[model samples]
Target: MGRQLATALLRASSLEPRHINISTRRPETLGGLFLDQRWVSAVLYSLLNMCTAQKLGAGKTLRLLNGLFETNTFTYHSLVNSPSASDLNSPDDLFPWMSLVDAQTKDTPLTDLVLRDKGLRDCFSVMYYNVFSNLAEG
Candidate 1:
């Protein structure tokens, strides 16, 4: 199921193989990995804050973040898989905001930030709500 979704996303978007993380096992105990309700609220708040700071509307901010996610995911994957072989650089030229977050977060990768901290995995409903709300407002 996950692989199917990943394949669809890859074909629909500019995502590459490295932009995806697939886990075959479904661990019953996610521990701190589970997306809490508080994290959902935090994701919304952070999105709004980021949109305001960047002077971009919610829709544009979402688009920009999407691009950043793709770029960062590939870069991070290269670094982890073959640090010596990969000559991947930061997306500072294209996504300064993403680069800043990547630098400030230290050990946390941008892909993890978008997928885990932003609750993208389990908070799809919340994200859909936000997208619809933004579309309605715009």
Candidate 2:
């Protein structure tokens, strides 16, 4: 689960690598979180470490995300395994946002600050992955 969070965080392309901070000491380390790709982040809440998840609250979590996204509304949908074009074209109040596009479509894409991360991991996760990957590749 910790690795999953790290993976999710590293996926945020818009975020400067220095902004993220994560633990380097662990079973998996931060290399498991791969960035430098166009793939979307897909983090399963169930996969998160129990202790880490326990420290989070739904409202608090939302607030934290909003802070990152820098918007009251931070929505992210995975591009790799996204819904069908028909489903996306369907009329709905809830718009699934994408991270790369910025057009005025019926549905708004999740290309903003916080929602940019497909997996939506915290800053710590992204930072750790950045540092770890650099060390590993170097």
Candidate 3:
């Protein structure tokens, strides 16, 4: 699932695989713990909600998922006029406070720390910075 989504995002040009942090158990590997671990039910439920037919207004969440999997871009502003406040994922999910593709920003120091690791730094796409800035004011 992670590979497919990452490929889709890369294919869409929304984010390159080198620009998306997937974490690692072994050096030089792109995806490791992200796919290997169990996600907290809450975060999984939320993501599942986004995948399901309803929950988000006008089915935008599902659309976002689809866009992430098969479109040229996620089209954040066009699909969702107002992105809801992001919920924090459990520590088990990694980067719990980092928003998805929504054009909202929040602090996730732990996430930042992980992303800044020697191997993972520079892995997240520019679009990620555009939406989720690491700057204190962003």
Candidate 4:
């Protein structure tokens, strides 16, 4: 499932597999797991950036995210079905359809949206920080 999501994101974005630092695991490494959070963060960031770069509408963005989630074995619900919220107070509250609709309706660029929306700015900041920190640790 992870591989599928990664592949799809890579195909959609300008990122290359080497950018994620993916490598073959050896038998000796089997006992220990190396779940690189940086890889996940990087892929997600790239995916979001691609969406913004393409100026995808809310419907298309939602579908892309839903498709990625559905790649896993678990039953995934559509993001559109999630209850709407007036404000996004935190990262957990991010992705309310209202925000996407606003962005789409206004045709706002990602940089402008990030600057104008505190919740979105904070979310991106957190993800960027995590990616850099994980890279340093790794």
Q: What are the Cα lDDT values of the candidates? A: 0.38, 0.38, 0.32, 0.42
In model 1, the runs with Cα more than 4 Å from the true position are 1-32, 68-119, 122-138
lDDT of 2 by residue, 1-138 (tens): 334444454553345446644454652653455432222222222211221344543345444445643445532232212453234442232222322432222232322322454454344345545555554543
Q: Give the candidate order by descending lDDT.
A: 4, 1, 2, 3
Model 4 residue 122 CA deviation in Å: 25
**Which parts of model 4 have CA positions greater than 4 angstroms off?**
1-29, 36-39, 71-138
In the range 85-127, model 3's lDDT, one tens digit per residue, is 2321221222122234321233233233333343322333322
In terms of TM-score, which candidate is stronger, 1 or 4? Answer: 4
Q: How close is candidate 4 to the true structure, as a TM-score?
A: 0.34
lDDT of 4 by residue, 1-138 (tens): 444444545575576645665324532465533333334333444555565566664446556654654432111121222233223233333343224334334433333433444543344344444443344345
TM-score per model over all chains: 0.26, 0.26, 0.22, 0.34
lDDT of 1 by residue, 73-124 (tens): 2233322224422433433212122332333344333334445544344444
Ranking by TM-score: 4, 1, 2, 3
Name the lDDT of candidate 1.
0.38
Off by over 4 Å in 3: 1-31, 40-44, 48-55, 71-138
